[model samples]
Target chain A: GAGVSQSPSNKVTEKGKDVELRCDPISGHTALYWYRQSLGQGLEFLIYFQGNSAPDKSGLPSDRFSAERTGGSVSTLTIQRTQQEDSAVYLCASRNYNEQFFGPGTRLTVL
Target chain B: AQSVTQLDSQVPVFEEAPVELRCNYSSSVSVYLFWYVQYPNQGLQLLLKYLSGSTLVESINGFEAEFNKSQTSFHLRKPSVHISDTAEYFCAVSDNEKLTFGTGTRLTIIP
Candidate 1:
């Protein structure tokens, strides 16, 4: 069985630019989540999606951050007008019941 | 609202020595506790979890966590750690399917 996977293992961008990080959850997994890991902030939840219900975006730091999960499988986290503070590793995970499987994560460096 | 607290930011233990990583959580209702570990240059993986039935859970590895509801704590422990045990560990709690993570603790195994 394949585990969760994220694209663009590394991304370097300039400030004010927009970056999109993609995540492919495990098959048949109904729950998906996005998280951010940085030196300042250890691990912060970004968003969560379960089936066709609304996503829990409470952990999103600002309005510039948004995410969409298509067909309840692939998820894309978009950060608009990227800032130096946004430089961090973005991690994605999928849940089947209790345990969550995480992806390698996409490291975004805002220079 | 749920929150996790990992008081220790880093722990350095000698090889074959016992280690304990403390994790405490606060929530309005009953919650599920989990420990996730990230090795060097790797994605986070489930170390252990306590959802129901037993208050203690153990991973295939030598790691184990005891969920103490009275203390609101789920601390990870290992009798004897190996050099490969060096990594970052995160404590998370969930009440309504949305997880709240702690700052994470970096474990360094000293030779």
Candidate 2:
């Protein structure tokens, strides 16, 4: 069985530019989540989506950060006007029951 | 709301020696605890979890964690470690659908 998968294992972009990171959750997993991992900021929850329910965006640090899961499977995390602070590994996870399986992550560097 | 605290930012242990990584969490209600390990250049992998029933949970790789409700802790321990154990260990707690992760503890095995 395939685990959660993320695209663009690494991305480097200029500050103020927009970048989109993609995630494909395992089939049939109804819950998905995004998190950021940085040297100073261990791991921070970003957003979560559960089935047809509204996604939880409370963990998003600012308005510039947003994410959406379409058709209850694939998700994309978009950062507008990226900042140096946004440089980190973007991780995606899919949950089944109480356990969440994580993806390899996409490292985003804003130069 | 829930939060996790990993007191030690780093833990260096000799191969074949016992090791312990402390993790404490705070939450207003019942919560689920988990230990995720991230090897260098790899994604986070579930090590162990404590959901219900037993106070102690064990992973296949000789790692275990005890959920201590009284102390509000779920510390990970292993009787002996190997060189392959060098990695980053994250302790996370979930009160709802979202997880709160600790800063993470980097484990370095010294041969």
Find the candidate with the highest TM-score and give its number.
Answer: 2
Docking class of 2: high
Of candidate 1 chain A, the 10-residue stretch with the lowest lDDT total is A51-60
Fraction of true interface contacts that also occur in model 2: 0.96
DockQ of each: 0.78, 0.90
Off by over 4 Å in 1: none
Find the candidate with the highest lDDT and give its number. Answer: 2
Candidate 2's DockQ: 0.90
For all candidates in order, the CA lDDT equals 0.91, 0.93
What TM-score would candidate 2 get against the native? Answer: 0.97
Residue lDDT tens for model 2, B1-111: 888999999999999999999999999999999999999998999999999999989999999999999999999999999999999999999975988999999999999
* Quality of candidate 1 docking, DockQ: 0.78
